[model samples]
Target chain A: MKQQSKARAHTNIALIKYWGKRDNKLFLPMNSSLSLTLDAFYSETSVELSDSFEADSFILNDQPQNSQETAKISHFLDLFRQTAGIKTAAKVVSQNFVPTAAGLASSASAFAALGAAMNHATGLNLDLAELSTYVRRGSGSATRSVYGGFVEWQMGTTSADSLAVEIDDASWDIGMITVAVNTNKKTLSSRDGMKLTVETSAFYPAWLESAAKDLVSIKEAIHKQDFQQLGEITESNGMKMHGTMLGATPPFSYWEALTVEVLTKIREIRRQGWQCYFTMDAGPNVKILCRYSDAEAIQKLLTTAFPDNPVIISKVGSGVKLI
Target chain B: MKQQSKARAHTNIALIKYWGKRDNKLFLPMNSSLSLTLDAFYSETSVELSDSFEADSFILNDQPQNSQETAKISHFLDLFRQTAGIKTAAKVVSQNFVPTAAGLASSASAFAALGAAMNHATGLNLDLAELSTYVRRGSGSATRSVYGGFVEWQMGTTSADSLAVEIDDASWDIGMITVAVNTNKKTLSSRDGMKLTVETSAFYPAWLESAAKDLVSIKEAIHKQDFQQLGEITESNGMKMHGTMLGATPPFSYWEALTVEVLTKIREIRRQGWQCYFTMDAGPNVKILCRYSDAEAIQKLLTTAFPDNPVIISKVGSGVKLI
Candidate 1:
């Protein structure tokens, strides 16, 4: 086996949104979700393919990987190896570029970069669709990291077709300001929350049924370069995801004091006629999607409102590539 | 002024379930729910002509009614007067005969009987449908008490047709055993819970879409006397309702220790091949629906299992009527 090269990848935030899954094992979703890859926040990973080890090894930010953390990674590697007809093991060394404890999409960058690096090492020369399928097996949202600018993870019937595809290059006026509310990991993981929604929530079907329509509308809105349409749909989708969590049998909430604060500030800013909108994942941290020109003013207002917490601003970024 | 006559009423438990309101003023539901009215538990009431006050007065179980509790009843009485073309107001005296903290359908009986007796006193000669419509304006479930034995409150688009109608007389081998858990009023009222579900739950539409199918299946199961089918569907429906509560924005739970205990015991009993099924309402108490012959055995087991608490058993009961 040839010595593997090291690489880095940045995380992306969903603009349309992906919530529930079609297949848990493969991390296949029921509907497509579009996202914008940012240049600033990312994860740096080094993958070395070796024959000495029996199984794959993962080290995140210089820490040794535990069984739980490596489970999804191991599965992804196994799929890639089986597809390539290779029996050798691999070692993954990864570091998140985002601030420690920051509730950001670090996994997106990690899996996306890992998928790209692993493919390069094996010389599979897999297409973007094939690479996305591998990454999705690791994390549902990771598929979006296969491309930079504007990307959409098309939720096809099977994992084979459910790969990330680039939409617009996003070389336009769009920018994102990530307000780091809390650096700590969230109480509810999106994977678990989505599973619970699928298993117990009576409202899961409604989300599944309407998601395609939402995606279509969001795509049209994005094409028109309308911030209001994008913001409204994004906010609605976020609410819908949270709604499913609330409907679980035991009921789980992905909200904190900071979540409320962020929402309040976002609404206040919006009421002031700012072209800024906020979207959150499974954590309290919020990423405001707005025009490049409005990003500075919005960031200023947010910093003033939350004097203690610092917000990170970045322009739309590119997808996985050789560094 | 004439002396008030003593009368009693019983509340019915809706099996099909009612949700969503078309008209807040009329308290009309979007769909009909089926319910059973029990005979052993009821609410007794009496009314008298009073010229000493400008408005009607109410006393519940020897306690003076507060303005908040009287508002709905007062409004209903006003509507009744307008519908019947009555001239004067009357004083209402009510007493509930059902065990107060047993989570029994006391309010159903109380309101149904009140509506019936009030109608009798008014010399309106209104049928059960008219009575149900009048009472439903006060409490949605109260409309089901106008008929006996598997009554369904048809959620007609109009109030005139949205009345409770009898489906079966329940003269078959059916019996119900209610295991008293905690009799305390729920912290989250159904009205508030429903409102929360409507406003916040992302899965609400999904539940709404599938409810009709569930109602149909349960109705068929009941007609076929398939205990397994009935039990399964009933449990699913109950779980769905509870799931919606959990999915509320803030999320709330209804399961108590006793709820768990009763469910455990029911599962244990079911293991022994007794065709017993459990159903619960807004409270922690559980009502077990089973064959008439198994009632005594079920009662004995429940009593022995829960020695600290009282377990009451009752056969299929009749609807509201004059003695």
Candidate 2:
């Protein structure tokens, strides 16, 4: 077994979001989801296995995590240890290049990097598709982070079948601009929100249905290189996922005042004959899906409108790799 | 037939909102809805029948309406004229005390008063429930405005059965405060919005199911005078209705930046031990449902939070009556 290994993984933003979970513990999503991997946001994780270590330790961004955070990492590491038949404890250090827990899918890259680093450290050389099931057990969206460009996390009936598949190279003139409306940690985690929505929201079933349809059409759009169809489906699917939360008992919304303002500006931008569309996750921040040719122009307008917020443009990114 | 008749009708705020239409021409909703009539906003209309008039004329707020507006009223008046077996032309003078086309249900009071005035002018002795069928042709929500206090518009199989019925007298300690975020005309009318939502929204079927359940629960809450239960259902139902719009083909939202700000402020007010909740229609405005005893206190907080907007309080109102 290797003493230490390091891996880096890029974050992905879901065009068709995965909301409710069919199996919470296994992290099996109720519907299939598709995402575009971006070059701008990622996580680098290094795992070191030692027989002398009393317990697993996790240090994030040079800060030793508390018991709860460390325990979560330790629990995830056990899955790889069991697969490789190792009893040694490991020390995991993770650094996030994106905003943590602000609906930027920080957890996706974090888990993907962790999974890749552990697989190397524990001598479990599984392929990307097989490794994605393990990454999904960490965070559902992390399943897609195992692949590059446009990836789809199929909602298979079992853990063996539910895995990420690369749909396209995403070599076309497609990119994204992330508007950091708020970088603070979200009050409700996506896991908790999904549980609440599945349990209490009457719209959950319909969300699953719409997501299934969106996945099929989005794949077709990607194949046809139809930017308009792909962008519309992306925005509609994201909004529909958020819409389910509004029907939960004691309904909740992640939108802030600036979120609506950003949406209004995006609508105005589209009205000016630009082919840009906006999508949001479980936070107030907005992501504009546009052609790479118009990224600078759209970024300029967004920066002018929101001087306080950070506007980031990212190109198509690659899959996880050992560093 | 009487030379002239004048009638006044109060506006209503739906606790369980009516969104999509099952039958567009008849104005029949896909699901039943319940509402509370408010004393603050209303409209008064005076209708005069005459054989000398070659065409129908409409004067709203003492200003002559254009052909389009007059034609809409004239078309509504035709429903009443057919019932009364009259070929006489009518001069309709209508005045709205509330903000017009602002999602304040101004059309509810306007159409209700017109129906009452036309009924009296043509010597039709139909009861309030019977007249509601004719008013429904003007606007779906106007059917509920024909009655005072808590009223339910049942989504029956046909036009005659899909009429408003009084649920309660609303003698309890309950009222509402309207935070007029934007009183200007809405970009998308409710009629158009409903059609788009029903046809394009994938979440529309789920909305119908939820509305049916909300209607039953809200009615029970009204019968028991349970303010908390009533307030929760009101906010959930309204938010669910708006949620459906976000799933349309080209998604749209009536929410403005100030609208979300107002909702956040209301949530903060609730967290501070105030028994107040908010409900919104197809516009940016928000209405806070609170106990009459807490109405003033809640209104004061909202006014302090949004000093630029008008914060108007309304108590239980009466049904339509002739002048």
Candidate 3:
């Protein structure tokens, strides 16, 4: 009756990372990437449109947002309005369980939820693929969050072709453990970082060149349910991403002492015969991939090593859906 | 009457790093590399060749070496004996002002000194070039340390052709600052790490393919005395080297928390318009390269940032020499 809709979308971790953008205007990736949505972190958003509203209003995490923060959402909403051919203003409320811009892929869930809520509220009736194309306009990773479990973001030539595809529901025994380290905003933003690496890093060319090969090999690994091969490739992909950062002109990194200690300990754990692997985004936190049977043990080991930090274990999650 | 010959060799930091081994037996590098010898870290060795000795004995840092370490020296001594046509047990006494096995390039100085001392003590009459070839048999980087300032190691087809040559004395205003983060022995030896990276890293091929190009470019920069080009390539080479480790099967790193902080601060310093850059070895420490004019200011900043760690400043140094 209130012309309102609510939706939730889970976040994801890239097993094969997307580092450089070929087209910043459309957020077109230079390489295809693979990711796994997690059950532990998600975003919920509700949108209401009516003739009674004076102007568009936005709220996040139970707080009113300033124009600067709301500007991005407002711009994204304009696209939905243009499609629906409606002048009515809307009120948007979003809440996130994931840390904002902390490299936990929060925007992936946030915009995925936003896209779903808009679809319901405006009665756009866009399917998942069409919806993914729109969702990616907000955040590149959000496209993958439109689908459940394993997904792949194809580095297509156009926006329509560049949508994500569901790879597997991950019915397998795979799991992930996250080490949430220093929550402080990154000193370097991903936008600036990607640009810096593309423009200045000597290895950026190599990163771009090898990404396709990596995607193909990793997809095969995922298909064969080869946990060792998958884990090894995923770990190497993350390191390659960080390596590009180090080769950036001014050179930057998101790793902390805790990150290195955890990495070293994880290597030791692997030597001890655990099939665990690690990946990191543009933040100091590290996400480890392992078998569900080993998740509890890995979490326990990490908890013991980093007693002061938070260790969260998560399983594969479903796609964005409306409630 | 001591019948001893003393030689001193200064350590060198690689601008174009030597990462992989093509022939492990002869310590042949997969790629040619360039380096700068520094005055701050050097090793001195006194070799006494006498028939009075029952067997070859070695002393390092004023302590008698264990059989394991002494075996390496004994093997190296066999080369000198082969060249001089004599078999004599030698008492090798060595001292280091540099941190051993901690990425400060200590082996470069240690082995270079050993080679020079053996040449003098045994009357091998090996020229500097021949001595460098002998030094490289112990450690690949030792070849570069045999020459002063700007030096290049040729990754040749065989041991006879693979040798180090001096490029320049670097009499210009260049200087290096070392932040010795930790003095502990690394858990993974360089030999093992190189082997693992070679066998496992997906990016190793790229690193090997790019080294010759980097060597040529850095040489041009060195000849022109272009600080920015030299510094940029040096920084990128280190990142590429570290990148191979990340792609290794079990994956490891030498970075710690302090390493990231220092890297970030260094970036901030660069943004403020300083002609300074950074490179790292196989440990948690960092080396900053800058003009001699800015060395003091850079050292002051680092000293203030890391009061607990030792900050050493060094200028271009001479090649290995007998006293």
Of the candidates shown, which would achieve the greatest TM-score relative to the real structure? 2
Query: Model 2: which residue pairs collide?
Result: none
Fraction of true contacts kept, per model?
0.16, 0.80, 0.50
Q: Give the alpha carbon lDDT tens digit for every residue of B183-276 in model 2.
A: 8877898888988999998889999988998988988889888888999999999899888988788788899999999999999999999988
Give TM-scores of chain A for all candidates. 0.93, 0.96, 0.97
Clash count list over all predictions: 13, 0, 1
Deviation in Å, model 1, residue B251 alpha carbon: 6.5
Error of 2 at B184 (Å): 1.8
Q: After superposition, how far is residue A156 of candidate 3 from its true place, in Å?
A: 2.7
Ten contiguous residues with the weakest lDDT in model 3 chain A: A97-106
Clashing pairs in 3: A257-B257
Query: Tens digits of per-residue lDDT for model 3 on A1-323?
Result: 24799999999999989887888878788888999999889999999988898877889999999988778888888878899988677899999988542337589999999999998898887999888888988999998999888899998999778888999998799899888877787877888888898887756777776667778988899899999999988888888888777656556677887788888788778888999998998888889999988999988988898888888888888999997
TM-score of 2: 0.97
Ranking by lDDT: 2, 3, 1
| Candidates sorted by TM-score, best first | 2, 3, 1
Tens digit per residue, CA lDDT, model 2, A41-92: 9999999999888888999999999999998988898898888888898899
Superposition error at A63 for model 2 (Å) = 1.7
Quote each prediction's TM-score: 0.64, 0.97, 0.89
- Candidate 3 lDDT over B217-288, as tens digits, reads 999999999999999888878877887777666566777777877776776687888878888888888998
